[model samples]
Target chain A: MPQGKPAVVPTDGLTTRQRRNRPLVVLHTGDMKGKSTAAFGLALRGWNQGWSIGVFQFVKSAKWKVGEESAFRALGRLHEQTGEGGPVEWHKMGEGWSWTRKQGSEEDHAAAALEGWREISRRLADQRHGLYVLDEFTYPMHWGWVDVDEVVSTLRARAGNQHVVITGRYAPAALVEAADLVVEMTKVKHPMDDGQKGQRGIEW
Target chain B: MPQGKPAVVPTDGLTTRQRRNRPLVVLHTGDMKGKSTAAFGLALRGWNQGWSIGVFQFVKSAKWKVGEESAFRALGRLHEQTGEGGPVEWHKMGEGWSWTRKQGSEEDHAAAALEGWREISRRLADQRHGLYVLDEFTYPMHWGWVDVDEVVSTLRARAGNQHVVITGRYAPAALVEAADLVVEMTKVKHPMDDGQKGQRGIEW
Candidate 1:
């Protein structure tokens, strides 16, 4: 059954329609897996709504090809060809600050992450995408490559109705506080705890 | 960065390939949203790996149209036409046991849920799909419409490398104990807390 209206939401002034239309900032974090996967699922939903979707991979190596990238790209191509669904743009910091950057030193990775954030900030300012997924974005912030305060402020000041989702472990407290929705994926059990390894498809 | 090898996996006894190939019973449970969405994301990954994906929606109303359903169905059609990706079959219990049962009484719903589980059990016996997503399945077992003991035993006895993922809130304790991976999605904050409602695409 759907949960009842939360007590935190005041029923005094705002109309139901107004409440339904509010843009959201979602954060998915914790020690468990599926944080990025859930964010991608939201992106898939956004794409189906004909909403422009942007995916930014902060920590995954460019060489590591995740399935959502392939699937979303296919959907994006379908959109371009028949005007179906929505456009999708995926960027990886591992590829460098720009898609053309293939390899770099440790300092370069940090620099690239900052540059990636700069681009995301610009996109937020322009409201370029209806849904933005910062997959594993918490790491860069945790590593001090991106300023959490600036991120919180930029997200707070973001224009339009664009929805943003950040996924990774140990999300900064400030970001969590600023987010309209926060889901902590707690690990109750893991195969790794049983000496099992992640396989293809299941892990990627 | 990818996590190092799991210490639980004995280094001497099992080869890395053997360790990576173990099938998993994954459970996504708790109050927060995105449980089924994460399973669909895994199906996307499995599809990309050329694995047949079966999605069984156990509780969502048949009238509800989730984006992952559209996206995966499209991908399924693509596979049929061009032999790319993998085949996909999506079944909804809300539409009746076989996706054609529209409206029904309360007892009818229970019976339909049982019938759905029967089919799933058969598929598990046959090892029909590489990835089997029992979306919102916990509710049926929780309601006593489906036998949790039977479900657990059948899953344990199932053949092949098929992976099963069950998603919903209030997952039974037995199932949790049986699962190789269990993630409890805790809600830290929500827009609904501020009187915001679920929107199309994002909610479905």
Candidate 2:
């Protein structure tokens, strides 16, 4: 409800237009749910603006399907058929790279995760999409499968106005410091605390 | 990243189906952006499952239009025309209730907020929607316009499986306690801190 000019005004001496045009690095991390949901929401906004959307799912099993993936894929098709919104590319590391790897092997998971990051890094370098959603990406970093320093540096040096959003719990301090916007989803209460399970439409 | 049977398994002896069937009261309260956006994302999920979607905005000005509103409305229309998704009803208290009230008067704003809440309460009683999004509703209670205790009691006693999501900053402690799910968006960093104003597609 507090409004007006924000307390942090641009001390960087950039013109208003320059400041407004800069791409952002957003981090959504914490124990609570909705981090990936919020990131997907942002992607929806970007899609409406004709921004190409790239969604990379890191840890979610291939057997699991979320509502956003279907919705975005449909929107992607809509864009293709009638040029309505924006294009969407959805990739799951579990299905894409880990299928060939041993299912429960830690080393195989780590390798697949690194491969996923490599692909994302390549996309960033090539400016492949307008919005990149690294869904549940913090796990690889937390598990030491991917290098946080490399991720930070690559994002910092990313060119153009392509926005990147990383969502997961236990985001590293280094990544938090590197992000332009960071939101921690603190858990005040959860139904699971009262022994309630997640519902189909609600949880996914 | 932590997964398995959630730590809080139902000690109440409720079946898994029974636990999943209970409706949720969710609160997204914080200073950071994306509270309402996340709620809209949930609405999108609900819509895909053929759930009626109700979005009520309490504090945002009528002139300010966010992308989710337009997107959800279009999806609603698509559902009607093609039998896809679900119905949507969006109402903004700023335009709907406060149009005749003095713009800057605190008392008038408070009164308008209460009237809006009354309408939502009525809808809840009727089980009018599958998902009710009370966007920025916390401001009224924070400003002492609406009674927080009354809101809590009404929600607790309400029947039916309709889910409710309330989003705003400064949510009352009592409301937090009553909610089945609560997520506090803690701000670690924001571009406004660097003096950048909200841009066209990204902000609205």
Candidate 3:
């Protein structure tokens, strides 16, 4: 058995392996720190499987370099040079994604986020990556910059075996309902509660 | 700022940077899939910081080759050869641990798990690694194999800045209280409920 018994078995006609092979739209949402980090962890597993990993960070502060960014960048380089693991493409709201938009063309944050979604949508259609990490992507949807219904529908209708994992708080009910795996990372304890500040290596 | 503003600032006498450098004991518990994967992800970040990583898997199923095992093994090799990232040590309940124990010399599962805990306790006393990931360690405590109070006390009294992350369901209250950060991975939705089975890559 691949895993232990399920809590509730459905009457879906598909065989166990068929059901197992289904693409997953995993949503990690809650007011906690490990959502994105867990998604990155999932990306590591997928990468081990030779899955092309693509990470799109929606809240792209230029100065906010999380530790995963550097580690994954090194992984991407390793893949490029040594053909070890799978390909990794990390795109934040930086100049590395595309240069079609002018630097001072007055492109607001919302437009840029929407454009990022568009790019991801195109990739989904083409089934570019085996695993997609939409880090902090639910914020734009929660803020109404991106349409939740459209995201749900697009992900539902995505082509091929592309597994997408989205991380952020306040995930829309529609998206949650559409997700195959939804993990609400509730905080049982946090150092911040004791007035302690976040630390490096652990927080990032 | 290492991280965004906290929900509440503490009155601790330590400065921000001082508080920031303190080690963390993170606990991932509850009925979910991504607990170990998330801990592995955190280890990746710690590895990027050049933190020596020590992962001890108490559930020593030779058949269960989790994706992170291969990925992190590659990272360990990369660090060894190229001096990139950090060093990693992975120990399972296999023969590689030591030669003191005879092969299948009537070592029951409970005794094996207890020995594993004792070894980890010794390592904690020595502050052996920058990050210690005790994968699936709670089952031993829950099953009355390893002493929960001992684990709690040992982790609390751990020296230096060694970060320890324990993941499993049925975490004892003492361990929860001793943890600096605790995440309860509640499953909002799961494909298994729909009669789907756990697959490779995602489930492993």
- Which model scores highest in lDDT? 1
> Per-residue lDDT tens digits of candidate 2, residues B44-137?
7888788899888897465334567666766776778777777888887766553335444444677788988998898899999999999889
Error of 2 at A181 (Å): 0.6
List the DockQ of the predictions in order: 0.65, 0.53, 0.58
lDDT of each: 0.83, 0.81, 0.81
TM-score for each of the candidates: 0.93, 0.89, 0.92
**Model 3 segments more than 4 A misplaced:** A62-65, A94-107, B1-3, B7-12, B62-65, B94-107
lDDT of 2 by residue, A93-171 (tens): 7665433354444457788889889988998999999999998899999999999999999999999889999999889
**True interface contacts retained by model 2:** 0.59
